[model samples]
Target chain A: MAGITIESITKSFAGVTAVDNVSLTIEDGEFMVLLGPSGCGKTTLLRLIAGFDLPDSGRIAIGDRDVTDSPPGRRDIAMVFQSYALFPHLRVSDNIAFGLRMHHVGKDEVTSRVREAAELMGIEALLNRYPTQLSGGQRQRVAVARALVMRPSVILMDEPLSNLDALLRLQMRAELKHLLQDIKTTTVYVTHDQVEALSMGDRTAVMRDGAVLQCASPMEVYDRPGDIFVATFIGNPPMNIVRAVARDSVVKVEGVEVALPEASNLPAGTEVSIGIRAENIEVHTEALDGALPATVAVIEPLGSHLLLTLAVGAESIKASVRTDFAVKRGDPLWLELRQGSVRLLGSANQSGPSD
Target chain B: MSAAIRRPRRRATPQRQLAYAAAGLITAFMLFPLYLIAVAALQPRTAVFDYPRALYPSPFSIESMAFFLNATGILPALGRSLVIGVMTVVLALALGCPAGYAVARYRFAGRDLVQLLIVSVRAFPILILAIPLAVTFINWNLYDSVLSVALVHTVMALPLTILLAASVFLRVPSELEEAAMSMGTSRFGAVWRIVLPLSRQGLGAAALFAFVLSWNEVFAAAVLTVRNPTLPAQIVGALGQSPLPFRFAGGLALTLPALVFIFFMRPYLFSAFGQARS
Candidate 1:
């Protein structure tokens, strides 16, 4: 029910920093996702926020309270672990009632809340069954139901859908978003899945090497990546980084020069790279105006379209074309970059174009 | 390739039959000594000495058992052994469960060293330590007491108990406890509500081991006590002087309790030994 303010919360193990000097402010009821690949410290950050692990330095606050020193129980928080981690010995009903019992809620209220939570999860029939008796999906629901019953100020989930199958994960992902939205509890979800982060989070904080590289709205992150890493990491088949050189008001991309009038003040002879998304390029069978000639290298078929890996000069770029468009490997085609799709991924010393 | 994915067996296969026969042979080999002891204990005193000793308890009589039970210091020693075994089980569990949990759950300084030391405690023979322990017990006025023998037995059984309990605790993932703690339960509360229940059967197996260890231990019991010797010590002390039937009867008396204990504890023992169905 409260916003979480994480202020330079740093934690390390054995001389390795798991959560670096990271600062973030999540507004009340916001679904903030800590997205990253394996070993990128997303789970470590979530653990710190949950009060399971203390930071070596810096502070964390939920609402107005500085809960940096508190244990998980004292922080008014609930967590759904990646493994579901349901009590194997207890029935679904008892597992849901466990937190209420720990917090010393009344008997009647515990019973009512357990029933309500079970019903909400569509698992009222599973109340009598132990966790071992339940399938992976059922166990996931029970784990979620267990946390939701607590109704803590903040709900922390560490890849809660990672254990389920693909279809179930997708279904649960959508259902969980709606469920959390209705509850309006400030939630911090940790995940490595880019699609999940893009689809679910109010704001996605993409992290790498224990530090957040970018934190922005999913669309903002998708359309305008802050750095080369985000540009490549966020997209499927990823954004193609082709070699380019800035020349006054124009950038020369391989043999083809494209007009980038926004860089009119750019000094000549400065080398740069342009990141173009796979879907951002339009493919033409015949030679067309404002299109660069390319040879198709690889074709992978999707249900509705084919992802074409095209060799444009020395660089390979991906372009998704409709299945009916009719293209083959080794065939020569022309590609036109969509407006605003080409992004300048600049070097450390130069201010090429990207802010 | 898929001739029959899972066909119902009409009868035991040849290989399975051979395996069953081998298993039955091993079982008989293991249980024959106990059967012999039982038969000797049940036979009349004169019949116990008969050559090609009775395979069955024919001309059945409790004469030797009666004599063994009535022997001076035997019943008291049996009682003392039972008490000490019970005490060892309790102490090993009380101390070992937490120690095991700590070893399994925590990453403190010298944790690996602690585990090494625990495992090494069983490397040397307890026989060498018994006299020194007896001396220390005498100085502390704990000598010749049931508690002294039980303490020694606890030391003897503890490493096994701790190692077994730690493995048991490891099976109940630490995340379940962390999840409980994250949901308002304190660490201790989480352990009680989550960990203890999950590991209860494994701990039961550990208790059975500790009790059997205490029940059979003779050297420390003999060294630590004179008047209040355990059943094993008493039987060993009397066996040399007592007649053959009395020895057989004493053997039965000592082995019977542990066998009955293992019988009751078979479920936990089976699970701990990994015969448990998922």
Candidate 2:
């Protein structure tokens, strides 16, 4: 129902900083995901927004109210925990109605709203069952319904689908995305799974060490990572990072000239790290113009594509080629890093990745 | 993998046979005394003194039982013990659950030391505790009353009850409480609606323990109450130098209530059905 604005938030526990000075804005109806590895402060930031933990120094505003100092009950925000923390003693109907009752809604209204939520989650048959009687996926739906039935100003999810099996996680990812979009409530989702972030988030905030590395659309984060960490962390087999140097309008990579769109922006003689996505590298069986010669070190045939580990001089890189590309280990090949697909990551020599 | 499917393959192995034997021996060791008491309590007055006692009562007579039941003070004292037991359960749960919850959920300074002290209250000998309490009760004008005996029993049962309650509370995940709070309930509401209901079985066990302790405590009841002693304290006077039938009858009377208490409390002491419940 309302967007949340967080400003300069910094939280620490027992002298260790969990959420450093960070600022973010979640627009109304925006599905913002905070994505990062463990100990990266994504969960901590979500807790701060949920009013479970107060930041040491910051302002958190839900809609127009400053809830930085308020308790979780007064914040009017709902959360779905990773463990699907449903009240085990309560049947599904009561669990869904719990928040409504807490807010002191009418009994009739609570029943109708719980019923509506159960239908929305396709769990109407499970309304009379205890949480222990439900499967993992069923419990997940109940937890989500429990949150959505409240219809609070904002909703927060902390790795909500992590406990489900892989296939179920995939199925729930789409279901949750559609559910959140249909509700049109501002949401903040936290997870370490890059696939979840890329698939579900309207805007993904890549974070590390208690700071946001990049906040962009999923495709933007994938194609144009803001820094070396974002580039390497967001990919599956991970993006290839090759040390390069900028001279004029050209960047030299492993003693070979590689053109980059932003090569002119870098200072001369500055060492830069070029990030290339595995699927971005063009592989050719025969030597062609402006291509670097390489030997295939490893080949992983993944049905639809061939994941080739190419050895270029002393450096190795991964390339996802078409399944028809016939190549074996130790086979000579040529690779072309296109200007559009090649990302100029942080300066590799002195300063940490230019943020 | 169903346990029923996996269980059949491992049955009657050497280790399982040895385990069953050991368990049977222990069960007999515990039940043999009760069996002897039952056999003697049923014997007629003349048959009680036979040199070779009957392992099981033959032509069982209810003479000892009738005489024991007809004893004037027995019923009143039994009623008094029931009151004390019930009172002890209620009082212990009310006073101990919060302290147990605090110990389980909070991280205050000296938390470990406080738990140790709470548990160490039992290390003081019961006789040592009973004498001082008797003096205190007299000074407070609470001596020779069911309330006085129940209060003494509460003190004796507190440490274990608190310990049991804490372990029970610890098992109910704090995540459930946080989830409730996030849904708009305050901390107090969450504990009342979620934590208490989820931990009822554990709390029930704690209550049962306090009840059994109060029911069986003879020393404190003897030292504190004269006119209103509990069942155990009332019968101890007739135990020594009493007729054989009377001794066996008193033993059965003393043990029967505890057996009934355990019978009612069995479900709470173990898991409810197959899964856990409040």
Tell me the alpha-carbon RMSD of every candidate: 4.1, 3.1
> TM-score, chain B only, every model?
0.94, 0.91
Q: Would you give the TM-score of chain B in model 1?
A: 0.94
> Which tens-of-lDDT digit does each residue in A210-254 have in candidate 2?
999899999999999888788878878788888888877678876
What ranges in model 1 sit over 4 Å off?
A264-266, A348-355, B1-18
Give the candidate number with the greatest lDDT.
1
What clash pairs does model 1 have? none
Model 1, position A249, has a per-residue lDDT of 61
Q: Report the C-alpha lDDT of model 1 over B1-278, residue by residue, as the tens digit.
A: 00122435768889989999999999999999999999999999999778887899989999999999999999999999999999999999999999999999999999999999998999879888898898999999999998899999999999989998998999888899899898887899989988998887799999999999999999888889898899999998887899999999999999999999999987778657865425
User: Candidate 2, A81: how far from true, in Å?
Assistant: 1.8
Q: Give the Cα error of residue B49 in candidate 1, in Å.
A: 1.8
